[model samples]
Target: MTTASGGMTTEQLREHVATTLTRGRERTAALIEVEPDELTAQHSTLMSPLVWDYAHIGNQEELWLVRDVGGRDPVRQDIDQMYDAFLNTRASRVALPLLDPTEARDYVRTVRDKVFEVLERSPLAGRRLEEGGFAFGMVAQHEQQHAETMLATHQLRAGAAVLHAPRPPAAVVRLAPEVVVPAGEFVMGTSTEPWALDNERPAHTRNVDGFAIDTAPVTNGRWLQFLLDGGYDRPELWTTVGWAHRVQAGLTAPEFWQLDGDAWSRRAFGVLEPLVDDEPVVHVCFHEAQAYARWAGRRLPTEVEWEKAARHDPATGRSRRWPWGDEDPTAEHANLGQRHLRPAPVGAYPAGASALGVHQLAGDVWEWCDSGFTPHPGFEVFPYEEYSKVFFGGDYAVLRGGSFGTDEVAARGTFRNWDHPVRRQIFTGLRTARDLTAAERG
Candidate 1:
């Protein structure tokens, strides 16, 4: 099994750290000229001040992983006292000394240099270096997370013009209406795999019955049909919780889409664009997804069903990391890393389809599931205390797959992400499933 840094060769560790640092530097350079005042000009629910967030990324890595645990001191030690999210209210506005954007960039570079020097000087053959390797892993992941957050900040700060919309593929591929999954026992959640997050641990076996899942995610056109059919207007289609959520938000349609006369258009990035009829519907909340599924005579897959279908079955030659196989993600294969910065037409990446013939299972937009955020049995918290435990009973729902902004590591199948049911800011959407017995036969 691949360990985070435990079993890695010193050369491997050096290469990983160098590559991660290069990525971080590139992301930092991208936002150096973004006007700070412009970033804070609007009350965007989707973003924070670009400069502030940029500094916070470095501060978090240095404070939490290096200084706090690695027994090193921060170059700007006062940052620890000022920007610690655990100590300061995340939502409360506070006046504090902040570096100019350029200064912040310099500080990050200085920290990176120090980290690189330390790694270079460390003795390779010992547990001490291994501990350093682990610390580097933590820092690398911390920066990866900030990379995603920074992308969101960029979209909000630079407006829609800066974020490119994905062009429709030259040809559209319509998937089979449904794929039938046979009833059987399958191992649910992560096993003794290499480097799984805490939430995916304590893998257990689960028994499931035959079910039919949509071959592709629900599309904007399909969801619009539901909306026009009074899907949201009818209370019968919504759960009690869902109805309340819809009422509170006063949502008549997906957050980004609107009906102009008889034509449908949506706010792409920050500008209005004609809705691509075949693109997978995105930015819809889980409540909306649930209601739409109910209206369409289907349901969201339980986490077990999703996992079983997306992963491979040992007995059936179906075991693969992604739906397509154990290959690394490529630009042509999945809509991720802001490659197109917009949701693509469903089934655009036939190469990314899962074992059950499900398309876009790993990337495009994050798909909401029917499961709540809870620990698997024998689950142990990771060293990062608040990552999972803080949100266990919160009003959040589980979203699988990574979105356009998600990094390759976070986009792993075992990675679990959750947000409140009302969050529609992120690139979130859904697919539907139905019990075989309840499926409307053609």
Candidate 2:
């Protein structure tokens, strides 16, 4: 059997389609507020009205995956009247009767189920492989896009006091200053394998002089030394832009971190807890990472350096889906899947180490790099143009790996995340690197 997304086998197409729907449902349930009269109040500038977004998601899925594919009409065809952003430009302007929260929820589920059934019943052969796959991939990515938007909306609506929870104490593990990357040239991006994102494309080769990266991400214990040395207090350690950001935000330490009677506590997810010495220091923005590196006599690695360290293959210069290998993520390999619901000790997953023996490259938290957000040579925008093109300015920094809350597919090694230096949320952190000359001097 084959699904409407003709490229994938019946099972593969079903899984992809189903997973997208599941994520939408999950995020909507988590973030949307229940209101009397089924009218969702807009609380956050980061989000559209909750009811509008909810209905919009379903309408989008139906339009792209069902109607665009020439499949049956959606179970709730009336949704197109009010929620279709493409068709209903005045949706917010007009006072439309909103779907009952229960009915809205069911509508999302019903559309997904009907789409799945259509795909399951479709014939395998003579399928429009490229077009169908593109349609499915677009909707899948669209839903993921909304997932992020909804998360931001939830945070805005709930306020910092309720949205950010504290993490549990992290286990301490000592780390060496450097892990050697043997001298070699490595393929730095995706090859002609499965679907490759545009930024990962035009897979290129580069020669990397051997160097060392910190064996684990810089930890709370290590960063504390930098802090005590008056790291943030000093202007020399900061870039001019960074210093300006510090003053504007009045950031004395990583966001959510506080000094409490000679000890440290940090606000995470929504609670406050004593700072754990061993966890990778998170909530630090790119500028903070840069400042800390300067103070510590180190620097952030370029994307090439990071990829060379991560994708090193002794023989055939190729990239691995993960730092370790092609195997899907498991809880034992990393602190992802919300298993611990917080960043674990940096060295907890020795198994997830990359080729150069860099640990936690796939999960726990995203590590900021020095590279500007630019396209790889010959890179073109994917179906979702907003994914990387809009953030090409130097204001954004490159972040590798996935965070505790990221889905497993998003955690793949080739996946790239970028954000502004001052916006710290969703488990951002950093590791450090030093020039070979400095390491030799030490």
Candidate 3:
């Protein structure tokens, strides 16, 4: 589909936008209300205060939808500077004279009201921004992205587990360890996906050699073996920068992990829980994933390889919009949104598995790839430069797939996520791949 409003008439488009925007707003409000006032006020260096995100989301909506598209006046011109994410760092945002929670809600509500009016009268089928309601989809996705960010902030906060959900029911899964993605040319990016970020535009063909990818992500039990074997102490196994970072951080295990005598446990959201042996190990940084890959005699899949594994169908010799097919995600498919506070067991989502039988390729944890953040052949900056252009550099490692904290609207197959290799605060992990060599076949 070219856009979320695809196959819809003007009124249907407006209703779709209204529904999506409401989902995002409700989640944002819920997140703000979930935490204690003091916790929401305090800023973590890793994230903006909840209040900042609450208002920043509104500022973005007003800027793009109301002011930019609707040609309306600003809702709160004075607060623009305060909520401008590019203008303020996470550390300083907390110090801003932000609106209280009640006021923030009012501000967003007012912006939304104006937006609905604009949607009602404005033409929905002219220009790139309005054609197929691109702007509306963009804004809703942006808001949902912030809602996921706010959800991450909630996870980073220290408190009781305010977010709750039922455990993912265990499914009968294929225990096969690896699946071979046949070597071939496959499309890597998207031009038809309307809300796809600029970085994922200009879909291009990527040629990858035959390789075997693990059926499931590395599990807590497997990572425990790495720890037992002095994975952190073996400087030789790590890149120079990674080794130095490991030393500087005095790291023995993943963040939120504790090694008490011979036992292992991790802080999930707010409570201490025994690490589930089958769940994909979350909070692993790229460097850690890399080191573990080396230990396993494999390597993190390149972004191209990851996409092929997730989107390409060797049988049909074509690409799919999502791993399971063009269909959007459903609760039966993957663990997503804020519906679950943590990842399900590694082999839990059989229906969500890729065409090649690569499990957990959609959601559970953000899988770290070996590629850095860079644009495709004809990448264009859309909406603004800060969204993707500013972050184009080797400083960031791309992570594919969404996490438990990811909102469904923001977690498409072509969705691109990147972070510093050493960042362990987000829901992150990796699935290792190795080339299928002739010697192995012989």
Top candidate, metric TM-score: 3
Residue ranges of candidate 2 with Cα displaced over 4 Å? 1-9, 12-24, 27-60, 70-107, 121-138, 141-175, 438-442
Question: What tens digits encode model 1's per-residue C-alpha lDDT throughout 223-247?
Answer: 8899889988999999898899899
lDDT of 3 by residue, 348-375 (tens): 7888888888887887899999999999
User: Any idea how many clashes model 2 has?
Assistant: 9
Arranged by lDDT with the best first, the candidates are 3, 1, 2
Best by the lDDT measure: 3
Clashes per model (N, Cα, C within 3 A)? 4, 9, 0
Q: lDDT of each model, Cα atoms only?
A: 0.71, 0.68, 0.84
Candidate 2's residue-wise lDDT over 1-442, tens digit each? 1223435665676576567556656755665544533236555433466666776777777876667564675566765768755444433523467676677777877777766665665442244323334455555555655555555344334334433334533444555668877666777766453344566766777777766687878889888998999998998999999999998889898867879899989765455689888888987898899999999888988778887777676655567767777666776677764445567886677677776678887777788989888888778776556556777876878888767656564556777878777877547888887767655534
**Ten residues in sequence with the least summed lDDT for candidate 3:** 34-43
Please give the TM-score that candidate 1 achieves against the real structure.
0.88
The deviation in Å at residue 409 for candidate 3 is: 1.3
